[model samples]
Target: MGAHGAPRGRAARPAGEDSRGAAPAGRDGYFDLLRAVALVRVVAYHTFGWAWAGLVFPSMGVMFGLAGTLMARSLRRPALTVIRGRLRRLLPPFWLWGFFVVTAMLLHGWMPDWRIVYWIVPLGDPPGSAWAGQAWEIVWYLRTYLWFVLLSPALLRLFRRAPLPVLALSLVPVAVLTSVPPPEGRFGGALTDLATFLFCWLLGFAHHDGVLGRLRPLAVVLPSLAALALGGWYALTHQARYGGTYDLDDNPLGQAFWSAGFVTLLMYAKEYAGAVGPVRSRLVTVFNARAVTVYLWHELALILAVPLTDRFWEVPAFERYLPLESQWFLFGVGWVLIAGFVLACGWVEDVAARRKPALLPGGRAARMGT
Candidate 1:
């Protein structure tokens, strides 16, 4: 039995842990479930622009932290080997989606730029069809994740020797970015984002290495609360800077502190959070397997929702029963499209990961069987 007597079925596991190294015992609870929630929250934030998503969960930081923790585990192998495995799992789905989006751009009358070959693997922000611009924005996560993974070996070594000092020093880059936001066109802005989020990424290393996780609850909680308070004060004081919202994205210093606080709290609380039943386990499996696919295609569904809703509202039967103005109608329209894409394209993740392809993680029948 897993934590809390859960089955710890295969469904509870995330991909990328296959055969490489067995996860430490008792590691199943929060990682997969939190990652799955973070993925959904990110998708929701993009689709709906919900302010509460960041305040409630800070999904992007959670994702980076999760990636960091997993990367820390992978680093047990040679650095080059770890990088190769991450890129191997990450790039295939990216390439598949990139090709489709690029082709769609061409059909939409976008001019062919030979430079778009960069979109094939997207080392940096590779240009694609203007129509697909929002779709490509999410690639920044992949780009930054790639950089963090590549740098982990060196970063991890520093952390192991002087963890507190190294973590404190990581905040300096975010300080610079917060004081002066980076310029728009060059790599400065991407570098700034990476710097701002780097603290949370490092916190993940602390979690994995027993630096933070072994501490007494109050020890972790007090520092986390202090960081949160500091960030909250900054957000409140600088409301005018972000157009009167507390969004961490527009406020770099705020993000640095807020994400660090959030990361520590979640990792520290791993002792209790989990999903234990067959039903929940299967959901986690599907979510974990389809996570990359869902992230890649959600923006496309969002873009298509506008036109699809406009067309659907024209039908009197649909319009009368489900008013176009209703939130339910909007969510329904968006999710139905997302689900369609998931069924159609979710297998791309499996293919990219070199697993046997299935429409969803385990297919409908397998889910039912579980």
Candidate 2:
């Protein structure tokens, strides 16, 4: 459920989506398209259990790369300032979401743990409770992002001084995490997940530094393909190792290499820029404008739709066909509910960002954030 393809740690979209604005003359439409597609893919995959989609696009990789690139750009401003601004933008809507979730769970008879205070303002993966586990799981992305953003000043400096070595060092975590089982503990596992994607995050730094764009396309492309191939081979053989599942998420080492390659290719920076039509433009605007709200609330909609759809299944005509259980039908329900949630809560993102509010922030209004 994490919107994986952008600067999503503090904000939902990449730095491209950092501002509420129009094309601004030089912005690429495809990044917006990439973020939009990644957001949809994360929600759809979570809803439909689409493992192939993760392999196909690797939304988290795309997101880390996007975030890393943007963080690099933001480094021009003071690091402390950048972190503060990001937190200010991120926390308000998140606090609102947390309040609703916690209140609901409390109403359902959850005894509050004093530890529950962490979830109220989570900096690491918020500990999930028995009552609303699925919703709490999404916090992993934000929590990991929090640490990465906090470390960026140093990480970026290390990367700048010794680009190749720093990147190679990043992959070391991938190897350690992948080859061995993480000791059973919250801190250990969180670090492992952070390591799983660390290389790609650094690769994002390389992209921002022009390391990727300067290379021959074949230099990046060929190695990335080879790494992906190796990842596939490793996963193919390890089917016996995991619970007979082919999910790459379970294979931390393989995913790190694969995502590093993927991010490298995506951030090659020299890739040609493109544009889309008015309708597509509006869609991108809406997606970026409400990205954080949508990412947070879409899964809630999916969870609620599960019980709601159960009622629909009781209809005699639809019972036979199981239309209510159809993947497409569930996706449609989630999408519509998400739209309504966006209409209701998206203004929080705007108000938090100090951007003007609109039911659909598009066209000239989208550009107003400059």
Candidate 3:
């Protein structure tokens, strides 16, 4: 039996130990579940309205926290090795998806509409005054991810020597500079969004430093839950006053608090819930194994699903019309298309990984399957 009394295959450790040769047994299943949940939350939050908005931002923070923890362990490598590893893992898949989207536009005869989306979709500027179109909204995450990887070395070094309070306080300037007042549109300002990235990454660093294990779940959960409840209420109450926009500062604070609570809850889930059933575990494992592929292909999946389904069923004209029922339907349709792309386009990334494993953290290839 695995740690949870389930089979041992659920959370597969990396093919080998980390670069520093540490044992991989310390892996956390809850973190895997959390990543899976966070990816879903992102899709759902944007797709299903704000029903779970309280969870999504914090979940991302949890992911960043986890990433930071891992980074903390790897900062000692030579600069070339670090840069190479990160680029190999992050870029190949990104480039493949970019090509796919660009091709789709050409085939659909929508090349002219590409001008605005071209920017935001490729981690460049958002369209003129308006936000980029739906086909490419997910790029925001990718754009931020690129920035994080670029700064990982410096961030890792700074946190390695600094006191916890010093590192934590170091983020204040970033938070303040980013937290300008809310904009007119529901769109979040770019400056404030940085706070979310820093907050999550720092949390990850702390997690690596054994911070969560120091606090009981209850201690972490209570205040976080309260923040989400009250903070959300406050945002909604004043959201309209800000011209339908949600404040990024308000959003990140709520998300950070909530993320801490969820991370604690996940730790408990592993200790208590045990195996999540074999079939479910296997399914989640497959999805998680190809996580980067899934994330990279999801946007393309959405774009492709629209046209094929459009022949028979029409997508809702407005974003609001997409409810749970509609989302589930879309989810079903999306899986079929994305699965095929994973087999084909995803292979492109695997090839690059094999050729230059050292480009990823600790010189590891992203595993495609068990």
Best by lDDT: 1
The window of 10 residues in a row where model 1 has the poorest summed lDDT is 4-13
Per-residue lDDT, model 2, residue 62, is: 79
| TM-score of every candidate relative to the true structure | 0.86, 0.86, 0.68
lDDT of 1 by residue, 1-370 (tens): 3332212232222322222244453334457788789877876777677755677888888888888877887687789987887788888888888878877888998876665766766667777666778887788888888889888999999888887789878889988777776777638867987897898889878766656533455667798899888877887789898888877767778878888888888876663243223324767777777778878888888788878888877899978876787655666677788788888888877766667888766443221100
RMSD to true structure for each model, in Å: 6.2, 7.2, 8.3
Please say which candidate is ahead in lDDT: 1 or 3.
1
- Model 3 lDDT, full chain set: 0.53
Where does model 2 exceed 4 Å of error?
1-26, 269-280, 314-322, 365-370
Question: Which 10-residue window in model 3 sums to the lowest lDDT?
Answer: 361-370
Model 2, span 1-370: residue lDDT tens: 1253222122233322322132234434556667788899889888888656767878877777777766777677788888987777777888888888888888888776556766655665565567788776788777777778888899988887887678868878767766676777778778887898888778867765656534454666787888788777776678777767667766776677777776666665333121222325787778877877888888899998888788887788778876775888888888988999899888888887777877777756343111
Give me candidate 3's TM-score against the actual structure. Answer: 0.68
Give lDDT per model, in order. Answer: 0.73, 0.72, 0.53
